[model samples]
Target: MNNDILDKITFDTGGLVPAIAQQHDTGEVLMMAWMNRDAVLETLEKGQVCYWSRSRGKLWRKGESSGHVQRLVNFRIDCDGDTLLLLVDQTGVACHTGRHNCFFQSVRDGEVEIISEVEISPDEMYGNKSGGK
Candidate 1:
């Protein structure tokens, strides 16, 4: 619970650090996000995932509207000391597209094929929080 470890982390020029979220039990990578100092503190203290949205330019709580909250199981730091690995217990689909993970498509040979389909629609997952067009 010491701040020394967190203090050593190096942030990018934008004052944001990359945070990788992984499924704790399965060891599957869920997503990667940016976190500012406050986001980090908020996550640790709350045991909920938080990120600094680059596009939105604000602090976003994981599953704030989608109800796909990622509960923090364990938090880790890489050897290089620039990134964080958050082991999470995901509530629902991690991707906005309603897939289990963000990486649904893989490069097979030279063609990119759709290996999975959206489990739910954007409206169902994100609701009005996304402000659809």
Candidate 2:
């Protein structure tokens, strides 16, 4: 693939761009992550979603351990060239908290509330007890 496309993206000072992953068929917004130049190219080349982990400070291949992978269907760039939208085929829960998606919180009656339940336990997903978010 031609790498010239990446030059158009407006990466932040940290050389990162926010990427939003959405379900291709249902259009469900699954999760949000970050990506650097290499991560974007790797995802395009491999046909799987790869992200730059801000916390880990490394390239994080989706489903590297948990077996919940996100396959790329379509990749898009925002008009501002600072954000990305990835249309993906999500295999399982997208959130580390074992929820279906990341945006599981909502405000109802002026109070913050949890809107979703865990589909799988953290131990089941990652083989450890504390499945952090």
Candidate 3:
């Protein structure tokens, strides 16, 4: 699979690099997550996005629970080699809050405003009330 490029990535001390998921066709950013070496390799091998869940301390297969899977289109590393960009075809809402993306908050005039509305209820996505990401 020519994964030699992985060697050039500089993961942090936690063995994780910030991965930003962006829509492949459009420029809309879906979400940001963390990826360890295994997560990165798994995503490449499986053609689906996988992330390291810092809160759960485990490999988080996106859409495993929400059915909002992200299919890998392209993977890229920043010039600094410390960050990664994943161009993906998103299946559904990316945010746990049921928003299309995570960056729903906007700050203007020193006031925080929500720029996006929830498309789906988190309860419906997670099948629970916690609405966790």
Candidate 4:
């Protein structure tokens, strides 16, 4: 199918939309990322998960810096055409904190708390600052 087929889909305010990655077999939601047109196009064309980095303001390939690539298996649009559900085969940790997923924490009692401990050191993925502050 051509990318044009998705021209009917509606994108939101930032010319970007929410994309959720779920495990193809187990149906576990792996992560959520923003996707602009180019990211969506590149994801489909490359079969690798590509996301728009909000903080750095650039296109970020999932495993480029962390070696935790998300392989695309399939994709679908929400009924309103504003959200995307991606079926993927994820490799390594999906969270920057090196957990299986970014949603390692759960909220309860109107407060947020950590449900999972760090699976790997942040320095392993993001490097560290030597200054003690």
Candidate 5:
């Protein structure tokens, strides 16, 4: 929790770094999000995944409202110190679309295809709230 550790990260010109969250046991990537310095410290301090929301322009704690919380198991910084890797225990579905992960689409033969199925409905996850997807 030292300031120096956080300072070592090379944030982008926008003062943000890309953080990738992966399932701890399976090594399956769940999502990719941005994290500011404060977010990195907060996640380490709180033992929860926190991200910087570019659209909302604020700190977004994972599953704060969606009930798909990500519990931090381990944290790693890439060799260049420009990116972060979060090994976490994901509860429920990681994607707001009610999928296990955000990467559900794939580009094969130059055609976009859906590779995964929705485990639950977005309405069920977000309580009939539109724009959750």
Candidate 6:
């Protein structure tokens, strides 16, 4: 892990960059989240995915509570150096809603449709935690 490369990333005014997580083998995009420098460094050092939660205002280790961990396979930066792509080996569900991926909605013909079914229930995933609506 090169600190020089990580330092070159141009974060937004809020000191955050968008990170898109994808399944390495399947190339399926799992989720998109925000990351700060600390999160990036932690992910690289720990071999697990970490994100900066705007709502929580802190570092969020993926699957800290749930068991659906993401093992880092590869990390990439976009051409602008403002965004990241993380190829990971996902363990269980990725979406907080108990879906495989966060992008489960499809917009077609002026209608918003759900493209995927929930693999696990929110109650089962987070217990009493309020899964984002």
Considering every candidate listed, which one attains the maximal lDDT?
3
* TM-score per candidate, chains pooled: 0.91, 0.95, 0.95, 0.87, 0.94, 0.95
Q: Model-by-model lDDT, in order?
A: 0.84, 0.91, 0.93, 0.81, 0.91, 0.91
lDDT of 5 by residue, 1-133 (tens): 7888887799999999999999999999999999999899999999999999898899988987788889999999999999999999999998888899999999999999999999988888888885232
Clashing pairs in 2: none
Separate clash counts for every candidate: 0, 0, 0, 0, 0, 0
lDDT of 3 by residue, 1-133 (tens): 5667788799999899999999999989989999999999899999999999999899999999999999999999999999999999999999999999999999989999999999999989999856544
Off by over 4 Å in 3: 1-3
Residue-pair clashes, model 1:
0
Candidate 5 ranges beyond 4 A from true positions: 131-133
Residue pairs clashing in model 5 are none
Q: Write the residue-wise lDDT of candidate 4 on 28-122 in tens digits.
A: 88788898888888898899999888877888888887777899999788888888999999987777777777787788999898877777676
What's model 1's TM-score? 0.91
Where does candidate 4 have its weakest 10-residue lDDT segment? Answer: 124-133
Please tell me which model should have the higher lDDT, number 1 or number 3: 3
